[model samples]
Target: MIIASEKKRVFIYKDTQLSDPSINLSKEAVLNFYANTYPELNNATIDGPEIKDTELHYKFLSTLGTKG
Candidate 1:
């Protein structure tokens, strides 16, 4: 008997789709990793892990707006 040991995780930031750099990193870690390139993510929130096909998808919801 054998078991599958791999699952793909994808993160969506605005108009960009980022691939997981490492399999061991947590979702939050992935977010922090990309924060260097996108500073706005520092205050951002995580959305879904919507499953599509065989991949896990996440969205970085930006919190960069003013209250009217």
Candidate 2:
């Protein structure tokens, strides 16, 4: 998989302090995190910022030499 297009950011905020901290992190940063967390997934890209509760998730797919 590839990063087919530029990231589309969506600001998330929680009015109460109890909520998790929010920040607009780049896709590359997130991907790097996953890559570091799980060494086996060395060549991968992230897709989608699927928001659930107060968290953001992405679809981590391994790169198979495909162009975006």
Q: Model 1 scores what on Cα lDDT?
A: 0.90
The lDDT leader among the candidates is: 1
Off by over 4 Å in 2: 1-22, 50-56, 64-68
Q: How would you encode candidate 2's per-residue C-alpha lDDT over 1-68 as one tens digit per residue? A: 67554334432212211112234546666556555655544786656578666455556566556578
- The backbone clash count of each candidate, in order, is 0, 0
* Model 2 pairs whose backbones collide: none
RMSD of each: 2.2, 12.9
By summed lDDT, the worst window of 10 consecutive residues in model 2 runs over 12-21
TM-score, model 2 to reference: 0.41
Candidate 1 lDDT over 21-52, as tens digits, reads 88898899988999999999988999988998
Candidate that would win on TM-score:
1
